[model samples]
Target: MNRFILLFALCFHPFALIAQQPVPVKPRILISTDIGGTDPDDNQSMAHLLMYNDKFNIEGLVSSPSYGSGTKGEILRMIDLYEQDLPKLKAHRNGFLSPAYLRSVTKQGRRGNAPYRGYSKATEGSDWIIKCAKKKSDQPLWVLGWGGLEDIAQALHDAPEIQSKLRVYWIGGPNKKWGANSYAYIAENFPGLWFIEVNSSYYGFFSNNNILDSVKTTDYYDKYIQGAGYLGKDFKSYYNGEVKMGDTPSLLYMMDGNPENPARESWGGSFEHLSRSPHVVFNSATRITDTVAFCTVVEFNLKGPEIVIPQDSVCFWMETPYKNAVQKWPGYYLGKGRYGLKYVPKQAEIVSYRFRSSIPNVDFGEGKLTVTNHWPGKVNNTDYKLGANWYSDKADPALYEGKIQGGKTLSKWRQSVLTDWAARWGWLKK
Candidate 1:
């Protein structure tokens, strides 16, 4: 072969010495998921993780559905399927964890979002988090916040000592809406913890990219997953077999390359470091024309019916729109004509809200706020670097869909990730 051709072939060869990465020690992981929730994406992501279980030190699989009907039963259902398919999985890879062991670590987290105080009573899942975080290990516990951050917040509140041992990768976009209080609790109290809050970056996994059409989300499952195995066959019902594993990026980030480095390029997208999350305040009722940052706390202070209560006892609620559904945030006491109410918009959608008071005297208030991807209102923050290891997506967009987003960094590697995943389908039946 010609010199240039030989060099190209050697570099691209699947089994070439340079192409092989040194086997990395499995990193410990604890996944909090809303598997049977409104969106079936968690189910898809969980299936993906189980297929690649041999890659990580899977510690916890807690059912923590922030919204919808996700339960431990749903998670256990997935495990049952994994058990049925285990024989095939082991034939392909030796280190696959036993289904019984996976089930043993699974626990039920809080049913819904945390209360106004950021944490409710501790659940089995929250306690398990404390247990796993406290375990003696050289590796830091990688807590993948797939759904609500309630259990993690509860765990941190229950044991602040575990903060030093945890590394969080939260999927916060719309899920953030489900657990604003818990998210706020963690952000305000545990600011020093090493955290990666990937709000929109996870969209890259299923969103449109420059990858081959066949390998894209719509086609990959049919081509590689349909006849694969028990888990693969069951995957069809979730989102009709199309790939929408938004929460899988947390697994991808640790799947290859250095899991310790967030800025480094890997199958999962690289991230930007940020010192503080955006926190904005409103003095009066916000108008539909008003705008706020995505995932940032937007504190509201309004002068309503002046009937005062004992330390703002009257409960104030707000109903906001989210992806064809109306979601209400309960118990924000801005009704004493005070600034006690604060809300965090999940996505970049225009947030229209109607405030309803539980007390008869305190009345209703309605308004709207346009949300954007920018960190602070009216301008993008260039100084996103942080002293602590906090990571997020860049405001810049090298690849644009509707606006500037950091998803391109992750989407750029979609082809390789999907190709590898497609190849693994063979293991399911073999």
Candidate 2:
């Protein structure tokens, strides 16, 4: 009986020990972007991703439609640049034969991808997207898309297996008043990922204010438009004088995430007239006379700040102090003005919450939005270095040319030049 009792106790002891073991914790992340084609803003975003390698075990970067070439091309080009341009130290550099390295450089599993030989100088964004999503299940992957929604859609389509593992935080799409693009069917097809769009006309939506208008083109032209320049002198000269039309915002969105000092980051939302709500002429652009009503107000608990398009809003900002503030309120026809108040029945107070100690009001244009208090404020400090602007914050394009001769490799030089331009253009933080 004693021996039998001892055997039973031993058998259950291991089971109890197993139950007491703690589960492993996964990493958290927040991705900033200026995706699309190989533009300065996108380049800045890539630099932000690379600099903060440790804070975010960055699963992958989703290419948005802001730059130029759309999602696939943007991802491929950025990845290629990282592979070709980023300076590799003696311990870090991978030769021609290695497989791609996806995870943070500090991790033990970090190595060259042996199987994908075609990834020579390729970014492998597609591979990064699928693999990062598959790595963990519990921790939410935060993807901030301040540009077009191309890469996220492609990632979802490419890797159905990891769809449930990630969440998307974007900043575009039509406002509540206007119906969004029907053809750009990314979120609709991939329901597994959480889709959050931050509308600009909405009160809390972030804005990429026309900082370009604030500076003169001739002030910084010809600085880096010479030989080996990304966009040569012809492009610069064309853009320098009034004769040039200027690059599209889409192109700017793709290459870099910002174009000015890292500290000059922007946020969403328009609250210029909140102080005088009812009396103010809040515009309502709802057009419905019968069964189908597209101008109805939708409300959700905003974990962060959200721009409001109240139902009761009248088209009041026609002129005066609120002229710039209320120029284009969403949900209204161009020539037509507001007729009445659009309201949400159960709507309560307007609430805005910020992470305890963030960059305050770092804006990334219309499509980008930040969650409130999602992580402790300390996370920002720990990951702050990753967000530092690698290029000079001066608003001069010539800085790009001057830096190339400063001991930079081909990749570093390219990155630095792009980053410098991005910082000047208000796509990156200082």
User: Each candidate's lDDT (Cα)?
Assistant: 0.78, 0.29
Q: State the lDDT of candidate 1 residue by residue for 1-430, as single tens digits.
A: 7999777655653222222133367889999998898889888888889889999889999989878889999989999998988888787788999988999999999997776667889999999999999999988999998999999999999999999899998888878877877877777788888998887777877876453333678877778897988889899998789888889998888886887788877667778787777766676678877777777777665655555555434377788766798877765553445535657786677777888776776555788888886653453352123347888876675644345367776776676677777878877856
What lDDT tens digits, residue by residue, belong to model 2 across residues 1-430?
Answer: 5998667655643221121112133234434344443334444344334422433344444433322344444444445544433333112333321115432311111112111111112234445555666774667665555453334444555566665576544443222121121112342344334443332221111111213222223333333323322222223433232211111221222223321212221121111111100111112221122111111122111122232444322222111112244222212112222222112111122222111112222121221112221111112111112111122112222222232111111112222233344343231111
Q: Would you estimate the TM-scores of all the predictions?
A: 0.89, 0.32
Q: Which candidate is the best by TM-score?
A: 1
- Point out where model 2 deviates above 4 Å: 1-40, 51-54, 62-68, 71-131, 150-164, 173-195, 201-430
In model 1, how large is the Cα lDDT of residue 47? 86
| Cα lDDT, model 2, residue 70 | 40
How close to the true structure is residue 274 of candidate 1, measured as C-alpha lDDT? 78
Off by over 4 Å in 1: 1-23, 211-214, 302-314, 322-325, 334-339, 376-387, 399-404
lDDT of 1: 0.78
